[model samples]
Target: MASRMDRAQAVVAIGELFREHGYHGTSYGQITAATGLGKGSLYNHFPNGKEDMTRAVLAHVHGWFEDNVFGVLASKTDPMEAVDQMFVQVDDYFRSGRRLCLLGAFSLYDVRTAFDAEIVSYFSRWVETLAGCLKRGGLSAKESKVQAMACMVDIQGGLLMAHAFDDAAIFTSSLARSAKTLRAAMGDRVPA
Candidate 1:
């Protein structure tokens, strides 16, 4: 088995490339090159090759969201502060929208079938967690769910727009609007 650091580094490198080129677009050679590891070393880490590497990358990405984004949303704290932290984590994950999302890219292709269950669970978990936060902030359960769905849509669409327009501000503004919506739901306002 590879060292823990080696595995972590490999997963991160794979995620970096996959977030841009996507699963099918990313080649084994590219993965090795990104990790500065030889083909044999990569194969040793991922004996099943690219698919195994992608699975590890997906888990790594999911774990990051679970810890950073979902954890903030689930925290019992000032709602707005939690909302801000969630967006901050989102921004960091996408490199302020300069990068594509690994899962988002996968969604555009038929290849998602291979990892459908895991991918769906990631998104569902995010929506449910955010809905819980919205509920705590005074939205009715139904309303909170609706808002959570909208937020997810906004995030996915906003990231696409940001990448296409080459403007990180597009995503930043979307997050601001989503946050404003949430704050308004809580009967609060961002001071002018």
Candidate 2:
């Protein structure tokens, strides 16, 4: 008799595969092979099939992101420094060891409807959080939201470009330029 796999293990395994190969690239067979589970075992855990498994992966990644990135931002008292630190953490994560942004990859996947709402909600929360940090740094509500969204887009776009080109330097350069632009926009508003 095959031992039943835990839900947490399955979620982590699926997320790792998705992170490496992306949505369209990864297959159920690959997942099964990674998890060392049979077809029936996979279905037993995720009755809704790949959609359910993807959702689980998203949720798992979201939690990990919040812990690593968002948590760092929220912990800092200085908003400007916090925002800068956020980007630093992002760069570090991507360059740490061939680590690509899972959310960014998932967003570009062709199966748009599969996890749209969840992905949107997660990103919306991230933007709002960043906007709040900007507001703390003296930007007005509208300005804060705009700056936050721009930063988010810059990071995601830079990462995609870097991944596509197989060049980490491109990502780092884009982030540096974005940081400079952001600081210049803040100008006298930024603390010494």
For all candidates in order, the CA lDDT equals 0.82, 0.78
TM-score of each: 0.91, 0.84
lDDT of 1 by residue, 50-126 (tens): 88888898898899899999888998466667777888888887877787877877877877898887789889999
Least accurate 10 contiguous residues by lDDT in model 1? 183-192
Q: Count the backbone clashes (under 3 Å) in each candidate.
A: 0, 0
What clash pairs does model 2 have?
none
**Model 2 error, position 54 (Å):** 0.5
Give residue 109's lDDT in candidate 1 (0 to 100).
Answer: 80
lDDT of 2 by residue, 1-192 (tens): 224457788788788788888887889788887887787878888998888888888888788668877776666787768778877777787772256777777777787677788788778878888877777677888998898889888888888787788887878888888787667666677555
lDDT for residue 187 in candidate 1, whole number 0-100:
74
* Model 1 regions lying over 4 Å from their true place: 1-5, 188-192
TM-score of 1: 0.91
Error of 2 at 50 (Å): 1.2
Candidate 2 local lDDT, residue 22: 80
